[model samples]
Target: MNRFDTDLIIAGGGLAGATLALALARVVPSLRVTVVETFPLSADALPEHYQPSYDARSTALAWGSRLIFEELGLWPRLSEHATPIRQIHVSDRGHFGATRLNAGDHGQEALGYVADNRWMGLCLMRELLETGVQWQAPAEVVDMTPETEGVRVALKRGTETWSLSAQCLVVADGGRSGLREALGFQTRNHSYGQNALIANVSTGESHRFTAFERFTDAGPMALLPHGTTTRAGHQSALVWTLTDEALDEVLALSDPQKCQRLQERFGWRLGRFTRIGECSHYPLKLTTVDEAVRPGVALVGNAAHALHPVAGQGFNLALRGLMTLVEQLRQAVEQGQSLGDLQVLGRYQRLHRQDWQQTVQFSDSLIRIFGDAPAPVAAARDAGLVGLDLLPGAKRWFARKAMGLGGRRAVISKPGVARREPAGHE
Candidate 1:
């Protein structure tokens, strides 16, 4: 008889958790998997059709992410609502340093793509419903205890409580993960002392599938091409960084006044800002856990590391880590080793640690170099930008890093691996 209730139990079912579940279902169907989530999910709850909204939240998927999804057979549906980033424009406000990277110059169709968060969740949920993975929604892991060979978790659903054991437990709740704290994981946080104002705006001219990253003395701002153009005009998702005081002042202004302020800071690169939608803001911080793995347990996604949104590298990095974990787990199954073996999990961490460190440093450096640099440093930064634009090899290197192709790529698929029925539960 099987000793555990499930081979793997994943806490939380948001983007990161859901994506990991779907990836595992595709790569290792033989392993029994169960996902515990706070929010309820059902076929009846999902929308049959997706309608794009101006204020809808979105995520940027780097080019490498596209390859990962294609391997799982999800890109076909996801691309339906995705807007390709054909070019990227990086510049410093009030300075002549600016660089433009074209997808054609890099021998690719697009550097990345942006898709609505709701629509992406819809795609992931739909695919997950058809898989063999079990679901426990409107439920959560109240607490967990590590054992010799596995972990035991107490789950609470509505008024009822139950216990289950799993050989491996994956905590992917979110940035503010309660499970992570309950597990006693230590973390380091560096606050940027800035808040990001997010909204969707329409301009007088088309975006031409271009994304803009403009840095100012206050902070950095990004404009990603949103969905298709409407009679309202071209649209783009705005992520404007501001001090706490500035954010309050801007949020209190009328729409037209807000547009004027934005125009002053962003210039007429996309022509005049005609309309702005509802606005939301969140504080920016760099949060990282001391260790991502322990015997019989692991953390993925935001639970492991939360980065600044200006760089748009958080989700892409998480996707890479989860895929690497899946690869290592696949090897464990083939070698007849315990899924929760420290050696197995450590190898996964060791293989992915370099990418994790490099990405965090890259994102952090961008903010520090431009946030409040001295005059001499500012001039050097500007000169560096100009040199990056002028040199072909340097441009390629920068472009690859931005597109998430600089690190070691994870192997997400193997041909001729047939699906097998999961082991029986006690």
Candidate 2:
């Protein structure tokens, strides 16, 4: 028998990595776990914490993921910062066709909830403290080499170099995953020729927990309800995907000027856009990694795929990726199979084969279908939304897919984190 350094070593302490740590800690109390993070973020959060010029913007939580968080005991804490999405309205630019999806339609209070990235991170961090994960904060994982026995990880914390070995390694460092690259995982990327402008805007009237997706010639514009925390009256977070030229205008503008441009685009539907909070921008790109696991390594989150935010699936996929791995790893352990074995990893790939493949294709085609500037294509886009609204089954399926739980479980669940409940429990 070969000796292992740690039970699990996770790189990247973002949501996926951190949440996985907590889940593993809960399921396998004796499993040794460690998280390495690169961010030099402050330990404390500012009051109201609304500010312009921030890195992470906001994210939507799918129902399936919410359940996982609820199980992990992170939802109640998150509810304080989340705004439930009671309704979602969709429309195209300069068209009369529109559709609205309500909680009543789905027989649920809301389809999902939206939270500012910072607040969500804070909530996860709280859970981490309780999870008992050994943290190596402000530490970047420089190298991860798989040995015959397990994997070795090299880290750099400021000017110091440290090493750690683990039986299995999880690479969740995101799209440009350094560890994945070092291991030679292949990735394909497609750019959207646009940049997304994200910020919080105060629209005077109450948004009533409604989310809106407005398709424009530039790209889709989304306003996710983020209940007012500032004097901005009624506030919502804005996501405007723009053409390079339009993005240039936005990037060059002063804060006040950018807010003015947004006010003109969104109109007074909510109210005049006023107070702005935390402006961030990113050029849109779509990417996918065929093999999520290599040798003794496994990948999750953006490290495996980066989706278009127009559909809000990046973090949703992150949750899905980690959940799938957790369940699989648990099962493998019980089955007496090595968690890092190719057989175990292959099962995960197979289980996610349909859902993940569909996700990438869905996001890719979704953007292309709606983003074309042609007049007829624009008409088709509106027609599609109007059609989905009128068709009960289509609308319901769409909601299910968007919620990240089409249910459809595989014949065999993946290995590595098989959790069994008490008798009469699921």
* Global lDDT of each candidate: 0.89, 0.75
Worst 10-residue stretch by lDDT in candidate 2? 417-426
Error of 2 at 417 (Å): 13
lDDT of 2 by residue, 1-426 (tens): 436767788999888888888877766556688888898656564344544233346788876667777666788878776778877887776777787888777777777788777777777777777766888888988888778757888989889998888778888887778778877889888888888888777766888888888876667899888754322236677889998899888878887787788867766677766677667788889888888887678888888888888877778877866766776777767787667888877877777767777777777777788776578877877788889999999888778766666633222222343444311112
Q: Which stretches of candidate 2 lie over 4 Å from their true place?
A: 40-56, 228-233, 407-426
Assess every candidate by TM-score. Answer: 0.95, 0.89
Off by over 4 Å in 1: 229-233, 415-426
Task: Give the TM-score (vs. native) of candidate 2.
Answer: 0.89
For model 1, residues 185-264, the per-residue Cα lDDT tens digits are: 99899999999999999899889999999999889999999986222238999999999999999999999999999999
The superposed Cα distance between candidate 2 and the true structure at residue 101, in angstroms, equals 0.5
390: Cα error in model 1, Å:
0.7
The alpha-carbon deviation from the true structure for residue 286 of candidate 2, after best TM-score superposition, in angstroms, is 0.5
Write down the RMSD of candidate 2 (Cα, Å): 4.0
Query: What lDDT score is found at residue 273 in candidate 2?
Result: 69
